[model samples]
Target: MSGNQGSFSLFQEILADQTQEINDLRQYITNQEQQLNTMKERLMRIRIAVLMNESVLRPFFRVPPRQRDPSYYPVIDMDLEAIEWMQANNIGGQQNAIRRFEAIYGMNLRKCKILVRTAPEEIVEAMNQRAELHYSPCYRRSLRDNSKIKRMKLICSEIIKLWEDCQSAAYPSDQIMVKRSNLERLLNEFWDGQGKKTEWFGKRKVNLSGNKVV
Candidate 1:
């Protein structure tokens, strides 16, 4: 129809899709883990029996036993310290997944790092091991593909809740941790690129009324 109508329709579709996706991810984050673990346990029991029979059970009656693989989702029993730390850093229990992945593979998941999954500091001296074999890194581009700018705001708000929940959480502590300038930079990063460039916006300001020049 009209240009404004088309824009509205596109916005509506995006909102609907995002809401559904968030709900699905929240459920998957909460559930499906148990299903994967159960499947893996059952598979292990069947695997032993299949190996003993040596397979070749003469085609007709012998069908390959169904085997389920464990989902790559991080299965972890986080330490109390890690739980505290994760809750300290990330709210809604999402950081646990990140910490578990870090514990196993030694990855750095800070925002600036762009979410690289690397191994922990357990360097072994093995001559036979290939240099690359001992160390592997994977990058998930999901960091830059954040669902929306609002999510970042929500994360900061939730983190503030956690700090408030803590015994020693206070303004001075965070003052040392994050500078005011840094938060200003964070705002700039999110608000930027959407509006016109501010680099040379007021470069040519004219002094019409006063004798002001810079």
Candidate 2:
């Protein structure tokens, strides 16, 4: 009976030590997981910063023609000449300017409004620069086709339809606020559909939709 009791005590001691070791291993695993997550988050932030810097510096770098989508046309012609003329003539009020632009360019009300509201001179200068680049020998040889431009026009028409729908649903008292909210919701939904969430990284409470909360 004495021997059996001593063996039982020894077994208990061994079991206790095994349990402690198991607990220690679990804690170590948890710590490792946490450290890995921290490292991943830091890497993600670094990657985002790199991408942003690249986008900002992209225009300054001459991308090889082979890397560029030859069929891709980025500039949308908004009748820059008409906009420049309006700006030069001191187009007074927003409404007046939109109306005058519409008349001058035979553009629809929506296009007229968009052009009048935006920085027309900057748009003109950017378009001119892009045109020069497009006419360059390397670009001209690669992007001689107009099929992509035609497709883009169709896409633009669809976008215009969506814009008009947003406009029609917006409240007159707070048109911009309502429209912006609706657009942000749509964008969030799009991201969600793609199995992603829209994330904003900033010190301020600014969202991906450019909305700031105090």
Candidate 3:
């Protein structure tokens, strides 16, 4: 082939290879999505089974308080030791451990909660006590127990179901909208149907204003 022909041939070969690579990537993503869906379904089924078991045990298990929503906040004194154990095991970093503690607390794990930044100077010696160190983590604790977690799960699961149904009904073609709605649903679940609950998902005017992600 002439030099000009050779160059054109090379460019065409490059394009063909790139197209094949793109096709392969697309197929990989499709397989991954299928796997993810399957896992979620399995997890949901397991959750349902657990809930059924809990229902069977309801008579023996202590009935939760009316005011107690099964959601309890984390208490530093109780949860911190576990957090430090998780951190030391490298399950997560310090910040991740802290954030998880915060999230668990938010999930309604405790009635009263407080997060300690560091041991106060007056309590520094007390904090270093071997017994205290054994019981408490560098930073983590739940003020509540698993007894109330059941109600919290029910509340969250209900909100998630409602959010899913809303998305399927209103925006089947666009799921970015669904995510926004889910955030709002979570807020409403937390706020118990307040007007401001609608604004629970921080305003994404860019998307809600009609700009679709796709």
Residue 15, candidate 2: alpha-carbon lDDT: 100
Candidate with the greatest lDDT versus the true structure: 2
lDDT of 2 by residue, 1-214 (tens): 9999999999999999999999999999999999997865554333223222324324322554334432222223333333343356554343443443344334555664574465233322333223323333322332433443333233333333444455546423244344334434443433243233212211222232333231
Query: CA shift at 9, candidate 1, in angstroms?
Result: 83
Which parts of model 3 have CA positions greater than 4 angstroms off?
55-214
Candidate with the larger lDDT of 2 and 3: 2
Show pairs that collide, candidate 2: none
How close is every model to the real structure, measured as TM-score?
Answer: 0.19, 0.27, 0.28
Error of 2 at 18 (Å): 2.7
Model 1, runs deviating above 4 Å? 1-151, 167-172, 175-182, 197-214
What TM-score would candidate 1 get against the native? 0.19
